[model samples]
Target: MDIIQLLEVLKPAKDVVTVQIASQKDPLTPWFDLAKAVLPAAATAFVAWRAMNRSHRQFEITSTRQAAEFDKNLAQQTKALRVQTQIATEIEIKKEECRNVRDTCAQYLSLALESNRYKNDFDLASEYILKGNTQFIEKRNVAHENYLESSRKTLSARMLLMTYLNPETSPSFFESIKNVDTSLVSSAPNFGGVVGKCLAECRMYIEKKQAEISTIATE
Candidate 1:
């Protein structure tokens, strides 16, 4: 109604308008909101990248350890294989040597038998000479020469066996061979039993060496 009353009502309205203006958003409010939203996502992405890197490093370490273990196992297998091969080779060589010895011993026995046959012929011719048969003198000389040659060959074969025989490893075989040698050279020689025993011992020795070779191959 009057100017003073209208001024009081208008003052209240002006104060309300001032408060609303002060509370209103600034011009940079949208940019601040965008930063807030982007910061959380960027932090999450950084954390994920770190986790992936750590996993990759762990994988690398595991792969390296596995590779090293594989190499060690392979080296050990190769060494074992090499050792087996070496042992097998040695066994084969020894087997061959045993065969040689067996063959040579048989040859010696054959020569000894031939020498005994020639000795009989020489003795028969000597008996004729003692009975005053002049024609038997040349035959006796020839038989004597043949007997000496056969004996020499037998001795040579026996010497060859001495090089191959091992008394320590093949004691029974060595003893059997000794008995055969003595029997063949003795005045009243017994050939049948001693010859059989020597050959049997040779067979057993060869069989034992063969078994060793088989074991090495399997391993």
Candidate 2:
């Protein structure tokens, strides 16, 4: 080939290189920089959205747990209130039972007091047996002793009536008051006698049962 033909071919190849360099460096550079900025902003927005979504889910879970806890506490409190109401009702019933027993004991005491009317008569007649005098008074003393003995017998008989009401006293009794059940003797028993003790102990036992019931219910 001639030199002109070779020069022409070389010149065209150099123009293609300049055009490629201009394409790589000039027109797309601004677009690539804009893409870099937009991509980072989009990544930051997506990360923020995900963090907010996670936090919202955590809040929903926390709210559900709190609601469940509230329901459980409310149920326990209601159960305790119901048990307390039941115990209060039972206590009132037991107290009413104690009142009934007390009334029964009062009736028996009234009857015993009414039947002890012979005490005044025996008090006056017994002085004659302890005095000394002439033959006339001595004869009167024998009459007085007989009268006293009759009065004593009458008093003993009156007290024996308690056995009729209470079959527990069907056994022997001592006129000296040492062998009879204390219910027959008004001079010794504390509240009233065995009858009174029976009532009091029964009420006490019921009260003890009430305390036990309260403890068990709370547990």
Candidate 3:
């Protein structure tokens, strides 16, 4: 039963005892009996109150612990988000750097290919000059050998004259011609014009290759 109902029942019983004592001749016996009965009831009510108080304290402690755990979890999640953001920023920076490096390498490779083409043309011209020189040295027909030697000499002279006249020209062309002897062009017919045409073709080839390389570099 509720505390109020139990108290009501106890009150009527106490009132009946009081009435009985008033009617009796012994007053000490009634007082002693009332004290003994009321003391035990008060003790039981105090125990019940203590048990409720302990349960309320335990609930408060449990709620505080749960709130602390939630805060700890939230803090950990925030730290992880910060770490992930930093990592993503670093990765983006590295990707940009890699793109720049790749572009630079592509430009360099394009230039290198043009340079290789020029070198190949230079090597071919040098080979032709060497072959002409060897044919001139072999004296099969004196006039034909003289003509071949004259052609070789004209090639050498044109290369030298271009170098002397256009000193600021590309060293790649000048270097290719510098090793040849220029004394064999004694009286060869139209050899100078032929050599000039060959040099012009070489210049045109280099210019074309350079233009192509420039386009690639820009891209």
Candidate 4:
């Protein structure tokens, strides 16, 4: 009951203590502690990275939209400026055309007046031919040539005016000019009145055309 009994009781308590020490010093214990310390920090870092990436994407999308809008506005402004320039250029061309037409009309009236001056000489020359006067033949020929040349110049100037004006729009003006030309031969009592009427009509038409050009420019 003395030494053997004491050894058996001591051996049971020693075995329990040895088992507890072996469990505490297990090979996987250090790995488990390291995982506990690092896992939460790694998870937080991943979440922050994902949030930053989403924010970057949103910023890029906003920037792209703004750039597209700016380009669209710029294109519209450029188109408007181009249209204005075209309108200005067209108005200048129309004004030049009006000036040419007015000049041609003046030339036509001048030629018609010159032709009227020759009408009396032509009538006299015809009388001499009827009377069979050979000495007056050369004088009659010269008067006839002058009349024909004046008439040709008047017609040419009228044709040049027609190139710039639409006949359908200014029928009265053209008709008045025609009446003046006819009066050159007939030597009508209303010759001066017809010339005056022609000038009035021409001036009216020119004013109308200029007004239209002004309207276009304002628009």
Q: Pick the candidate with the highest TM-score.
A: 4
How would you encode candidate 3's per-residue C-alpha lDDT over 98-216 as one tens digit per residue? 44433432332333333333334444455655778555333434435444544544554444345332335445434333322221122224334433543554455355445654554
TM-score, one value per model: 0.64, 0.41, 0.32, 0.68
lDDT winner: 4
> In candidate 1, residue 50 scores what lDDT?
97
Q: lDDT at 13 for candidate 4?
A: 50
In order, candidate lDDTs are 0.82, 0.53, 0.51, 0.83
lDDT of 4 by residue, 1-219 (tens): 775566668786555433233435778889999999999999999999999999999999999999999999999999998998899888888788778878988898888888776766777888988899877788778888998999899889878877776669888987887788788768887777888898898889889879989899888
* Model 3 regions lying over 4 Å from their true place: 1-23, 28-41, 100-219
Candidate 2: misplaced stretches above 4 Å?
Answer: 1-31, 107-219
Tell me how far the alpha carbon of residue 75 in candidate 4 is from the true structure, in angstroms, after superposition.
3.5
**lDDT ranking from best candidate downward:** 4, 1, 2, 3
Candidate 1: lDDT over CA atoms? 0.82
Q: Number of clashing pairs, model 1?
A: 0
Stronger candidate by lDDT (2 vs 4): 4
Q: Give the residue spans of candidate 1 off by over 4 A.
A: 1-52, 187-189, 207-219
lDDT of 3 at 145: 43
lDDT of 1 at 194: 75
> In candidate 1, residue 4 scores what lDDT?
52
